[model samples]
Target: MAVDDFNRADSNDLGVNWTESDYSTPNSLRILNNRLRMGEANGIAHYNGTFADDQYVEATVTGMQFGDGQTGIAVRVSGSQGGFSAYAAILWPVSGRVRLYKYVSAWIVADAQVELANVPYTLLTDGVLQFSTVKIAAIGATIKVYIDSVEVISVSDNSIASGNPGLIARSSYWVELDDWTGQSLSYDITADAVTNGSITPAGVTSVVGGGSQMYAITPDSGYGIFDVLIDSVSVGAVSSYNFTNVAEAHTISATFGPLMGQRALLKIRPENCGHITINDNSPQYWFQHGDNIVIEPVPDAVYALKLYVSDFPDAALTTGEPDSLPDEFHSCIVDFACYALSMKLKKWKQAAKYYNIYVKNLTQRRKDYIDRKAEKRAIHQIPNNIKYGGTRQ
Candidate 1:
């Protein structure tokens, strides 16, 4: 067995991409099942050969950001080859948050959520984390996952719809996970939220109350909407909105003008009440604790530009005069915000007769913000990859 199987000597981060060998870093050497004589990792360890079919791969990686770069072992993964759709090994530093992402066709989120043990800072004897394990169970359209010898999830959607499989890794960076088990698949519901009476993984809400209940489905793809009836009565009928029933991560926005008279597009989302630094970027509206942000690539809109918060949480969640710092005392507002959105989006009927789920719990202030933000842009159209101090590394 090749001790330097990853071929550390030829790995470097050219900013554009990493070499082929570095693409196959591992989370642990035990993945070899004592088959290979593995040693310390220099970070980059990729499968430098051609592609294959139905392969099981695993690895243990160390010294990587909580959510950056493919720091784990990869098997029969596919990328630029087809827009990065593989099971990356991510070990949350200091907390050992071991996880495997089946980045299917959607490059943003993993096929399903896999929670390993919390990674600790001590694993880095010298920026090298202790051996971790990542495994895969691929079965056509559906992909199952396992970590540390434990099965996690059996996704219902394609992990990465259509593409060849191979290893993946960022340039220069270092992360390793080993367990060269074939590959995995996940027939997961892409990040797109589908709540037209269906409880999907997007920001959801469920409210139940007296009389009849109403709901406003703010999808990641839509503007043309209609009034919703629970039993049968008039509740919230403002605009005839149009939305594409696909998959994607969505926010709370009001689409009023897409129908008839005075059509206006209004949006309401959370912003950080602190500095714009990395430290303050937590509690991002898009993702909740423990893999709540189940994002997906939704279909494009017709005759309209699909509005979305691209650099959100990263850019949207910021603190200023209106934003307040996070505290147990003031945490109720945050919970309220999440609950309000979820309930509104959920199949909940938690209001008096004839109340739209979108309007529940929202005070006058929330309404005002939604009204004002109607003209804001929600995408990151950066020309070229711009690099700052702490970019997407």
Candidate 2:
């Protein structure tokens, strides 16, 4: 996407992304109040990037300095200054006429009147600042002209093969231009996935000018990818797929199925611990589903399990639920809650009192509960499944 809102400091130069040509002496093109203002007639400003052959340039004409002159957007612009090849969609506000013109070399003679809306020249100056919007699209041999989003002209012309898009003014100045945007034609790709599975970026995505994109396939726990399809044709059970240099729209989907195996999910767990050992042995393969653990080659015997964790609740405490903190230090939680409530109610004095009490109780709780632990450094092992999200990437 190429867009220039002209929101820049006032200057004769339009920065590095624009090339300017003055047909007349001292052609002044400056950015003022986030709009492009022209000071001389017959001057053109072209965007610096090369655009595809099939592209469109559009701009909202907020102000027209002279209704008798013509101003519009040009596409497939080649050459520079005096001589250039471009298809221009010109608009004449005074006569309410819009025209399509093909410019070649130093002479711009060919003109085809596309539409005449019979709009008065005084209507633009009668307190209204914005009048018309001009847009031109060149695709293949077809050149289209649009006035205020209404297609008025569709002609076949292939004189210009490829170039940049730009803004041009003829016998016009101080033509305020805003929301100038240009882009190559783009196509859409729709991606979908069935239940128990997902395709990354699963939606309608727009790609331009033979762009490429990649999609990742993922299945829910205890499920395996069954099949993958592109454009309704099966592409096998691939974990990922890529669309290289995409030229047209496409569709992609994936299906999944439950894995065939004896499985068990252990729900009971200590807070803030991941590693697990059964019968003093670490299971070689296991994955976590939510808070539960799923171990492969399910353990057959009743075994003792050990893990490291604090007694505190794994998640925030909800209303009507008892906290995991010891009963002796329960007042600390109450004090903190009171402090938060007081702060919400904007009672600073009450909030300060509760906060001080919370700090005092917290200090006592730390001394009673935390001091019992011996000063020692221990390394906690991370589960292999969690280390790589249950996949050996």
Write model 1 residue lDDT over 326-371, tens digit each, in one string: 2321333443444333223221233111122121222223333444
Q: On residues 21-97, what C-alpha lDDT tens digit does candidate 2 reach at each position?
A: 77665444667788876654466677888666778899887876555566678888777766876777766655556
Model 2: residue 2 alpha-carbon error in angstroms: 3.8
Lowest lDDT sum, 10 consecutive residues, model 2, at 380-389
Candidate 1 accuracy as lDDT: 0.33
Shift in Å, residue 369, candidate 2: 95
Best candidate according to lDDT = 2
lDDT of 1 at 267: 27
What is the TM-score (0 to 1) of candidate 2?
0.49
